[model samples]
Target: MSTTVAEVPDAHGPTPAGSDGEELPTRPTPRRSTLGQRMRREWQMHVFILPGVLFFSLFAYIPLLGNVVAFQDFSAFRGIFGSQWVGLQNFANLFTDDEVLRAVANTLIISLLQIAFVFPAPIILALFLNSLIGERIKRVIQTIVYLPHFISWVIVIAIWQKVLGGAGPVAELLDLLGMHGVNIMTDPDTFKVLVVSQVIWKDIGWGTIIFFAAIAAIPTELYESAATDGAGSWRRMWHITLPGLVPVISLLLILTVGNLLTVGFEQLQLQQPAVGADAAQVLDTFVYFRGIAGGDWGLSAAAGLLKGVIATLLVIAANRIAKRLGTGGIF
Candidate 1:
């Protein structure tokens, strides 16, 4: 008598009795909505971002096309398209120009000073504010800090002038004390320091808002657990708070490095008369004076294009370093 055999599944379907038990592969179902259909479904979300998208396209991306002037003997009379192409001549001039090089050097020096001093001031302030037990006091302090950020640069500069200029209160105090009063506003040696101080005083509070928010977003449980384990305030901050702020810090650092060459056009331009271009000349002012005032369109455009390229590369390099360090980057 033959033994009863069980049916076995195979590649296609259930196999006949005594067949192998290999299973069939199933095909993935096609997605129900096409990309267009999906976009249409989320039309409102797209609408929400449309204005921002359009604004950048118009002001940022569109202006990028003008960089072609960097490669041409650009003339206002002939216009960008009518201008004769000069290949690398403009770039050559940019690199060889003494004023451009000087501007670049000044920009680097000022930017480094700002990064070293101004960058960390907000974080320190944020930490101090965060550590405060009284919410009402913290709110009042934050408001005071944030107010300067809302003040125009012109007004801020005026205030600084009134407080630290040759005849200002500090100088007056020095005069009363029988010490020599210094004109800080026009002193080239101290211009970089003045710029850094202004940046810290004006934007430090606004900068703290982000760091404070980041600190607030950190879970209280982490701090509570650390405290339960007998960790003191400094230990808790070092272990929990700073680690939580790494992502935000990394992001801001990347942005700061990327903008190393910028160094505040309006602020620098306004102060140039006081300190003179020898000390205050930066890439932005160089471009403004060379292109707008001196009518050296091609040269200025080349300088700007170079600055933009360097800034873009800095951002890329910074992001890469951040990723390697295991911190979240802007990318």
Candidate 2:
């Protein structure tokens, strides 16, 4: 009789207890690790990351626990642990508070203006810069434009105040011409426009860097191929350059949406004295007034938390829309 080795069963396979079959020892999965092994393998990377992890834990994570105060009537004397639970009282008050509502309205208005105007300025500036042939002139222009971004908001505000104030160069020039001086800094009607203009003037140059880098990254082969196909400069820019910028544009838009409410506390705070809270108050400055100045810690914390949650949702929705439209996402 010819018995085939293929008919033989392994010890790990099905076996009858009464047949004197021995149990096979199980082996660990190739990818499975004991905790000690994993720690030993990743220890170097963990060591490298420890400081950053510690800093975030200390500064960010630890402070997050204080958000519980938002749900309570927080008192400095009673401490966070001992506070009385208020259950939406702070949030309720936020809607009813005139200053808070005004701040919310002003914030939304300024943010929309920024989205419409400031967002496009950099890309346009970048395209202009990219088209310039002289490298030396390009570098000089880039340096001059980027200089404003490094200037402190205080100095920027001071300069603007000096220029647009009743006695500054612009106003002085108007005075010499026997024309009425425009006090734009204190005009509530033009506050949103002024803020948007300031954002463009201050950060537009620095913002161009990302778009310029994106423009530079476009393969020369694409433009060469387009040229071979009889495409003009305008056609190349329309077909290739703009499309190349879409990813960066989408990313920045999503980030901007996420940070819509965070229009620089110091900038508005400095301007508020001139424009008054009604005109200059945004959500950030509102938080500062309530939390730091007014000492209504719970109310301010709730407002801030709400704003953050809204911003996060906006970013997520924007990313989803971008992905559906066939653009690269932040993820």
Candidate 3:
């Protein structure tokens, strides 16, 4: 009649049966806390995002409900509730509308230009900057370039107008060289090029920050190995640096495609009058004119909705293509 002791099993695993022909008791499993309990415990952290949540709910997500106006023959006086439901009439008109079609075409052209020129500008700049040996020179160059990104689109346009306009330095240089009246700012044929150039100048440095980070993340060992294997600077960069940037490049490309129709609302609207609808007039400007100026709110909403859907579809398609091509997508 020796005293008996209850042997508890280890928390990690159950133990074998004891000599007394009874299994050891296991430690009790921990119970999961309820959502309410977790929230209460993490209330302080939640407080930080409370304002952003409220702001988006009020200004972003909640207003999405107004998209219903796309279907209704909406009027300011009659209101969404009182407006007549015209079903798909507004959407149908979008395909038949010349203005909408023109906007779509221009948007597509500008989007292609941006992807070709603007998207890669940053990657090249980052590589060039990363190749620089002087940290001081690199810092100064980065500061100067990134400063333009903070400037307003209005100022950016103004700067470009001064440099490329009829009386700008470039025009004066052309005038001196017997190529008089070579103004690009007002030239419709070159307007798309101007837009793409402006985007590159402004955001290239900002975009490079990500690429520089990606390059930094590449293992120095790979570069050393490549160098030891008789690889030159270009060879190492091509094999190591370029591959490291693929994931980031693919992700940003997907996001850029999603905004395919956007093409900078402020930037395009400010230049549309100068270039006219033929060379400018993106989808955003079309919506502005139709909705606010022309008072065709329903048709405008329909066009807006249509563009949004197209952008969304493009993002999905681009992401799938990226994934299939072996680079990871944003999703």
Candidate 4:
């Protein structure tokens, strides 16, 4: 007697029956891992993100908790928990202070000036450089310009002091020419000019990188096609290069608006004594002087909190405006 094997049918779907008319064997259902097992599988990815998560939590979120100091009369002797709650007193102090108003005024004036003068400079510079024929020379010039960005603000200011301060080279030249030696470094009258110029010198090169990158990303075929259509370098740039950079420009503009009040704390702080708070007082410096230096923690924290809130709103408004204007927004 010969025996025959009969296959069982698959449970998921129909399958061919055996000669004995039995169904084929079905595949087993797949089982999902538990939450713990799933987490274990992604352990490497979690490890990679852990350090950054810790850093942000410590440096960013932890400090944000200190903003509570704005609501309390904070003192070293009386810690955060021990401080007396003063509700809106700190905020009130900010509104009533004349120096706070002056600081805000100075910050806005200088930042707007920077936006007007310094912002578009790199775009122009990049375009000019892009139009040049020699790649090696372009690279060399880019490197030279970008070098200043790496220099510390302290050193940058010191160098400016040497060049523009009284008895320095520029002042000495003016003195020798029978002109009154004006102290650019310590002069309240010229502080805005000095700060703006320093900002341009330090950042213009760094800013050029983005514009240059944007310009470079434009297709060579576009330029070739434009040339075929009787377009010159200037024409091609006007039509192609500038349009390509519009997105980046718009994005940076929005960001700059957000940072308008963030006019250099260290820069102003370093120069404040020489130029006096009247000329050099920006919001950041005011916070440092009043909060950290003078030990008025509550008032400083309140002022800082207000500044941050305003800056955030400005960024949101700028982003919305950009989107409405048909430009890419930061979000």
Model 1 residue 159 distance off true place after TM-score fit, in angstroms: 0.4
Off by over 4 Å in 1: 1-28
Q: Which pairs clash (backbone N, Cα, C closer than 3 Å) in model 2?
A: none
- Which tens-of-lDDT digit does each residue in 215-312 have in candidate 4? 87888999999999999988998999999999999999999999988998888889999989899998999898898899999999998999999999
lDDT of 3: 0.92
Which regions in candidate 3 have their CA more than 4 angstroms from the true location?
A: 1-15
* Pairs in steric clash, model 4: 7-23, 8-23, 8-24, 8-25, 9-23, 9-24
| Residue lDDT tens for model 2, 1-331 | 9976756666777743344566555655688889999889999988999999999999999998888988998989899888899999999999989989989998988888989999999999899888888999999999998999999999999899888888788877887888886787888889889888998999999999899889989999999999999998889999999999999999999999998888878888988988788899989998888888889999999999999889999999989999999997998
Model 4 residue runs over 4 Å out of place are: 1-41
Q: What is the C-alpha lDDT of each candidate?
A: 0.92, 0.89, 0.92, 0.91
RMSD of each: 3.5, 5.5, 4.6, 6.6
Worst 10-residue lDDT window for candidate 2 reads 15-24
Native-referenced Cα lDDT, model 4? 0.91
RMSD of 1: 3.5
Candidate 3: C-alpha RMSD after superposition = 4.6
Worst 10 residues of 3 by lDDT: 9-18
